[model samples]
Target: SPQDLTVSLIPVSGLKAGKNAPSAKIAKLVVNSTTLKEFGVRGISNNVVDSTGTAWRVAGKNTGKEIGVGLSSDSLRRSDSTEKWNGVNWMTFNSNDTLDIVLTGPAQNVTADTYPITLDVVGYQP
Candidate 1:
């Protein structure tokens, strides 16, 4: 393409939350993309790390391959299951606790170049 267009699904293999993270789950999401339809989220899961640096991947609400852990997007909730969105929420942890996050989705206007996307996770404390 002369305009330089690259389409790809942004894969969030893992995201780790630190002990200072709030307990509340995902309260909101902010996405920046060139096309709405071109962007879609999926497979948002988490893993908590203990003081020993051990990680325990939380099971997904859905009982299927990779289904157990993922973003639990709105479409997935309405069409697939009735479970809450907690399936992709960031959980609280003890001292030195770290969260391992994994989020995968489609992206538009991708190009054959090095691009970096940063995910900033914030939640309410309760």
Candidate 2:
């Protein structure tokens, strides 16, 4: 695979803290097009939580598949007091985080010039 895939900081908002710092988990991931085909997995570090500690390939339309990279925790708590947003405070949590992805396989069956892949993040609170 070539160095064609890219990772960006997708703004995170509407975050809430659980009773404690909820552990991170990989909810789901979806890829868009063939444009993300040349990327390959390297290594992911930081505060990422790998529930299974194993990454799986998401079955796609053709030979192209979305890879499940995992998820991380971005919940922030008030330092001074127990402040809860009663539909009034619009406090959001933004982290200097990134979605690490790599391309492994080639385009399968689709014939579209460029495919647009989308990665999704889901959080679990307990």
Best by TM-score: 2
Instruction: Summarize candidate 1's per-residue lDDT along 1-126 as a digit string, tens digits.
Output: 122212233444333332212222222233332322122222322533322112123332343222112333342332211222344433222212223322223222222222222232322222
User: Candidate 2: where is the Cα deviation over 4 Å?
Assistant: 1-3, 20-38, 46-126
Which residue segments of model 1 deviate by more than 4 Å?
A: 1-24, 44-69, 72-75, 78-126
Q: Write the per-residue lDDT of candidate 2 for residues 1-126, one digit (tens) a residue.
A: 432323453333332222212232323222222333211111232222332222234434554533333233222231111212332222222222233232223322322222233332221111
Give the clash total for candidate 1: 10
Per-candidate TM vs. native? 0.20, 0.22
C-alpha lDDT of candidate 1 relative to the true structure: 0.27
- Write down the lDDT of every candidate, Cα atoms only: 0.27, 0.28
